[model samples]
Target: MGTVFLAHHLSTDPSALSPFALKVVDKSLSFAADADRRARWEISVLSRFRLHDPLHPFLPSLLGSSENADILCWAVPYCPGGDLNVLRHRQNDSVFSPSVIRFYLAEIILALQHLHGLGIVYRDLKPENILIQQSGHVTLTDFDLSRSLTPKKLDPDPLHVACSEPETDSDLSRTFTRFVCPRKKKNVNNQKGLRKAKSARVSPVSRRNPGSFYERSNSFVGTEEYVAPEVVRGDGHEFSVDWWALGVLCYEMLYGKTPFRGKNRKDTFKRILMMQPEFMGKQPNALTDLIGKLLEKDPTRRLGYRRGASEIKEHEFFRGLRWDLLTEVVRPPFLPSKDETELTEEVKKGGIDIRDYFDKLKAPSSPLWSPSLDEQRHNVSLTEF
Candidate 1:
């Protein structure tokens, strides 16, 4: 447990406390957004465990959180280890046991099922987002782009619905606030940022009672790379986007890259719009079949029938899974031996390296330098903190 503590929700005022991790909001503006909105965003996450809690074996449990300045942060149980994506990059990564991979994939399916059940769709499902705990537990993180699997609220406040996509500074700040909230010197730009953020949130979209909500005027947002087809065409999106991302993440995990690789903004969107991704010798037939169904352009036939938890658990790839006996299911099949490195020393020191990596990714650069990440990746290392 964190020496200090806060609420399970990342947005709230619980006194000035430090807990699970000492994350810093990269920008001061986002850190100041209203707490109730943050609470709602995180509720989508915490409520998800009704399908997979301690019994699920893979997902992480919510520990707690605290308020530091205007930001409310969660104390997610620290997974004192590394993520599968990091493991894959190492030369010894080839040593990853097949059984562990199976366990990871199995749990992912269950997670998807649980989210789908509640009508929640996790739009960004990457290997890096899945945490591997010291006890071999796998907790999913970064549901920031996740959409409601059920009916979306009729009139969500645009102020609270921000994300890092759709090219809005507010979205970037919203992500920045929670992802980066534990710095001293980093606050250099914060004073001005907080002013700008406050204006954005307070500038009334309408004069109809400041506290009341009406229809949102903002576009739905997501990282361009992981965004789904229906979303790009302005045709409207749903839980299907999550499945598409899941396919992309799964492909990248096994093949070492996304199936459709484009460096140009128009080209990437065009590729998604018209081209068929080359499976090459990249993955096995079962894997290919699974991705093909997900990447289909048509939202209806795509994703197969949105199945229940039992049906998802019984998919061909997920064979041998005992739905009712989930607790008996083994940990992800391919764990790297729990070396000394597996128990992260950072956690012992009251911090986690997750924010370090994401912080290195940095809050979105100013609108002045705004460029597609693909273009930026060629010229700059995004991971440089």
Candidate 2:
């Protein structure tokens, strides 16, 4: 769960707004130990590219992030529109119309296009992690695990690449951290944070859950339910991890539950690594076939590896989608609304920048308002005094 801060107000009532949802990684968690700080810095570093990327439903446009940004630890646009995960859970899931799924797919494709063009691999892609804006746009968010592949490729020596799996222990950390040293160590020049986090062979999962462990306890990234097979088996991991996750998400969306789930972690990875996904109980054949291809154990066989997002969209399931028309399309399938007046008043108390996020978009082709690079660097200092 994340701290609920009001990021902005909806356009329906320009006078008021809704809350922004931002999840801060707990310092106690290995991933978030420095992830919050890293996310903002990464954006700042990539602001040049971010400024040029088109505003679309698939990516939640970053507003601003700060060290002590209240209500939410990380600032993002307020999206009262919720997401597919909430919609399916609260209401019900059914065969989405071609219009609905196609439109959403376009947004997803566009998002991937931008990220991939920049050579940024978003390793985590899931419904729960996505954001559907108040304006009915879908955005892929939670880029904390994203990495730049092009930069790493520049190293002339193969030594720069991660080493092969170790034989001493089943875990990879024990064998690697000694030499693998984090990528951020040189960038941030933060040897201190690096050393503390590196002092681990295996980080015990949080105490809240007795058996809790790293997302891919095998390698130390995403959650167990969504971790990629390559990561679990100690195969070299890369940006493609996100594509693998996208497959998992597509599977979960069509079915109400994850493709590979178990009572415990060991059993879970066993299913992911060995078992094949099946179309269970009255599911669409088209959806099932898509997932079967998606949940392939080998990353090379998975969707979006060689051919890219267009290829994934062109899969038989999306045969009818007009890729050209998708970029400009609007009006998603189901748009939920509460009492406009009540929501507006509630938003006034919801601490987000209502005008900046919701009303500020000038056109679909052009976003007139975004956090200026200067403002993003030097956060606003408010006074409650």
Candidate 3:
């Protein structure tokens, strides 16, 4: 929806001094209206997360923002390790081991849980949107597609009760006291590798299912391959859609591809509505079983539909996981090296001005129309999709 630039912020206050990903959109563009709205919505969501005493570790913190007659801009902490998709591509088989997937998925679930508690539905949940922080932990990004809906009130259940106090050190430690690592299994079919393919992003579908649940969004949004079946059927969706996408993500991490991808978007949506996820192993393991439940076509039958993330957390696949000690893990699946974290001399002195870069783009006839020095050095450019 907007372009992202790697820029350095210089300030007298040490706390404000750091490199940030500056996302900017030219207000003069034809599509700027919708993009502007999405940007503001995303900022609002991040600001809401900050209201908590200690912000959710897996969520982004809005650093600053700016606006003018021609452009709008906002800054977020820069992730040096890129995103999960890039990290997965770097792996030998372009897939993660079960342990690595478990670690990342645990953090992601907590993030989603916090969001659900606040009535937010993270419609988009894919590897590209999962960024690895400098600390080697995962933080979700791209909240533009996220929607806020009122949660349904159900009969009293212990699993549905919300935590009264913030998670204290003792509370977290207690939760992890019985943690145990899962045993690894060897994949027999390693020779047949899957090719990297981009998922389709289609315009919102027009159909709507009025018979669907009350707290549901009828808007057809999300990447095609990761989209939920209810969304494809225009049957409305809520928090369960995120779980469905999570299943797609987990399957992709294990098998190197999405479960329902077909030759085209039509065929893809058809498969999503009709087919079951295929597994490589003959026997059903905890991980496969978890994916199967999460990928359930019926939103009501989905694993996280009723109790939200709590239902997913109770699955055998995540048994004995130290939910609270996730941040304490000294080593994660992957960490950015010293070289990746280093900034160029030019960036150290003073990064390029985002406003000036957009101004140059406005003047097509100017010499700056060609790739500028900053573009060559930092690869800064406008991203529209």
Candidate 4:
């Protein structure tokens, strides 16, 4: 839908920061309307974050934006450490330790909480979208798939059931029975064996009446592997979907792969609806226990469904964590080197003009095409931060 460039802000003020990531969406593209809508929504969401008194530390701050006859563009601070996926690949086992996961997950939870406070549901929450700032702390990116919905009011007697006894098979079956067809009752007898059977089908259940305090979005948008079961069923989903994705993210960090990924999207969706996460250890631990509750197939029973982030923060996995001192930790799991933060000589010398570059693409095919131009264009495409 767009291209991102490592750009320098040319300004006379000495206080101005120069290096930033410039995202450009060409208005002439075939999906211009959709691209334009996403870009505008992202900018609007970031703008609201910038208005907060202390400004959310973990949410992206919009530097600026502009639109022309042919393109729409916006700028955000560049994260020199790349994204969590890149950082994880750098690890020896392509996975993070328990301590590392806790630190990063804490910051991510805070960011998601802030978005929920503003009535926004962040539909995207995979490792690729969690960028590592220069300080090594995580910040969420890519708000294009996000939507605004009224958050559910906190229940007066919230169910603090995350650490309660695990749900029995009967309980689980009852939670999902309404979504499965009555004719498929025979399949319920073999709940343990359904993981291997590809014939079973669970249809989506539409909500008859949505609550007045909260609005649900039926838009089916999210990365296939990280999507919630509710989303896969096309049932209207709310903020709990993020919690489900968080569980997927946590599982991947510990096990080096997603819990229920199948051979194809169809099989994957089937696994999401039926299969349970397979933990490696012999006994239950705080981390795995937390992931289990967060991955609850019923949105109403998910860990953060009732009281939001507060419930997760109070879990054993995050016990003794000084939430207020996260930013002051001084040492995160990974930090970018000087090379990663330094601007190239070419970038320092005013870099490429984005608008002018797009104009060249529209020019006649005479003497303008060259190997160097092609190389530069490739570089621009690969430099998204």
Candidate 5:
């Protein structure tokens, strides 16, 4: 919820010279309480993966954190390859080939699976938050919007067993391995029947679902375009929401833009509620079919609703994928060039000391205090009509 900078540790010890992306939140802002909470929550979430044994290569582990009266700062490995969105734009057609999409999507699925396994729901899942590693593999970033829900445990069943079985796709060896290049657009009008316009986006929340292992939260929070229909309806949502977003991410990767986006925010919500995803210039395939199933309006009916990722892993789209070998693959779709991997000296200048940057933002006014600018504008009232 604040600015990120390429930074180096301020310590004099050379052993601590590794580069990090430092996120700083100014506690002097009007939304300081909420911002502080989100920052703390993210640190807690990342600590799990950072401290746990068998750390995930597809997620950022917290390097460190510091907070004072004026600012809060935390660091993670800096991704020089930028985000998936940047990579998408670098592609010749601004879209990825099917094989490249599959490669990236598989890693994302694995990342989400690990998060869900830890009882955390990654409420936000857009291309911007999917960071590329120096090795060209993907790592999920920005967990401040994520929610920690109670883990759901279902009674073991035969369908679950069958779905969890990983199949090998020989075709994967022959698939296109080229890496690709990757917004939300919104529209609003005074429609009579429109629901009161909340902010175009929502925040993540923690809630428990009764009589079900899949925790359901009622908080209205997510980027507008990627929000699941159940979430839009204010129906309590659970793990299935991530699957819906994964579908959106997959579609955007293949087409270079998000499906269901409309002229504005309200129009986008309407499309999300009523329209189907448009597949331009391509015939239907297992991938498209899988996207369709994941985007089903009814969360209970979504592709991964029952067995979670295991169900999607068994789909024809991923038929030949060697899930276990994903991390071992030597040739990924794209590798970040040396420039992207190393922090530039320009960024390192003054950025090494994170506290100084945020300290300058603190004001003499009390943290929660707001100046009454309205009082100064007595003669002019724009809303007088």
Candidate 6:
């Protein structure tokens, strides 16, 4: 829905840092109302984390925002090291080492744990959304797709909402069987992309505030590859979906690609429902076991479903972890070099004026870029970071 730009604030104070990423969304375009609400929601959510909190040290805090006129914009600390996706590409094999994965995943778990504590479910958890801070720590960006979901006893609906998608009993055993099978060999396209979506998933349109805290939403949203089976099946999902996505992210970090990705979205969704992740090469025992548990199709049986992140923290994979001192690790596996942090005069070099960009699209076309007439060609990314 918008573009991210490298920006800075002019300040006289030497201690006042200015460099940040500014995300601007134009609300005068199509789906204006829904887009406007999400923009406001993101600002509200980030403002809550603006204060320094040791528990949420890795999460981004909003610096400021402006909803003036037709544009909605906000500023967040810029990560000079770029995102995890970029860092992964820097590796010789486009994958992280076991030790590097351990350090990064440990910090991510803590960040997710803190989000769950605040009654928020982070729907988007992937390499792109995971930004690297200058301190060599990771900070999660983008909260537009996330919503507040309170923990409450799920009542049996007389309407039979729970029974709509009958739970598959034999699938659990089938999953275990597939786990031992040799993973399929990597194809040529795996080198360039971790996994790119061919099309955007259809999300429910809404003028209403994302349901109240006590309820659940059946909205089909989130990146196609990262979406959970529960979400794909359209059974009102809750906190467990995050755990499922966590499993996908873990698999990608270790293997350089998402476990269930296929030739297309249809095939990928089918794989998510019917197949299990196949580990290649020498498997990391604890880590592989942890991924299996997280990817359980039955949300109720998923590893972190009941007790949230605490259940995963106690798993054998994270044993001997020093959660408190994660921030103190001065020499993380990869740190942004001086050149990465150094600002050039052309930081905003190809940046578009968001408001004018939208205005020009609405005008009659000339030789320049214009909105596509073919319906299939137009797809919104819905990124409101």
Candidate 3: worst 10 consecutive residues by lDDT?
A: 173-182
Model 3 Cα lDDT, one tens digit per residue, 8-63:
64554222236678777778777889999999999899888778767778889988
In model 6, pairs of residues that clash are none
Question: Sorted by lDDT, highest first, which candidate order results?
Answer: 3, 4, 5, 6, 2, 1
lDDT of 5: 0.71
lDDT of 4 by residue, 1-385 (tens): 6777766645542222456777778887667899999999999999988887677778889998887787788989888888898888889889999999999998998888778877888999999899888888888999999999853443443332223222221110111110111221221111121122233245533222223236677777889899888777655678899999999999999989999899988888888988899998627999999999999988867898866776788899998887777877778878999888776555454445556676676688645433344435532322222
Per-residue lDDT of candidate 6, residues 212-239 (tens digit): 1134556677887888876766546677
List of clashing residue pairs for candidate 3? none
**Number of clashing residue pairs, candidate 5:** 14
lDDT of candidates 1 onward, in order: 0.46, 0.52, 0.75, 0.74, 0.71, 0.68
* Regions more than 4 Å wrong, model 3: 13-17, 151-214, 362-385
Query: Candidate 2, residues 1-385: lDDT per residue as tens digits?
Result: 2223333333443544334444333333334446556655455534534465354335655555545322224556656566668765754563344345556655675677557655666666777667666556676766666666543222344334342333231111112111232233232111121111121223222212111001112235677888776666554455457777776777676667788888778777667777777767765666567667767666655675544564566678777665555534556665557641134444444443422332233346554433342233221122110
Better of 4 and 5 by lDDT: 4
Task: Tell me model 4's lDDT, rounded to 2 decimals.
Answer: 0.74
What would the per-residue lDDT of candidate 5 be over residues 1-385, giving only the tens digit for each residue?
5766555544542232466666778777778899899999999999888666667878898888877777788878877788999999999889999899899988898788778767778999999899988778999998888897864454454433222333244222211211111011122221223232363333222121213344567777889999887676555777789999999999998888899998988778778877899888889998899899988877757887766676788889988888878888887999988755654444444333444434443545425222333123212111100
Residue 172's lDDT within candidate 1 is: 10
Cα lDDT for residue 271, model 2? 73
Most accurate candidate by lDDT:
3
Cα lDDT tens digits, model 1, 220-310, are 4565566566555544455566678776766666667676667765566666666676776544565577778767766544553333233
TM-score of each: 0.59, 0.64, 0.80, 0.80, 0.78, 0.75
Worst 10 residues of 5 by lDDT: 176-185
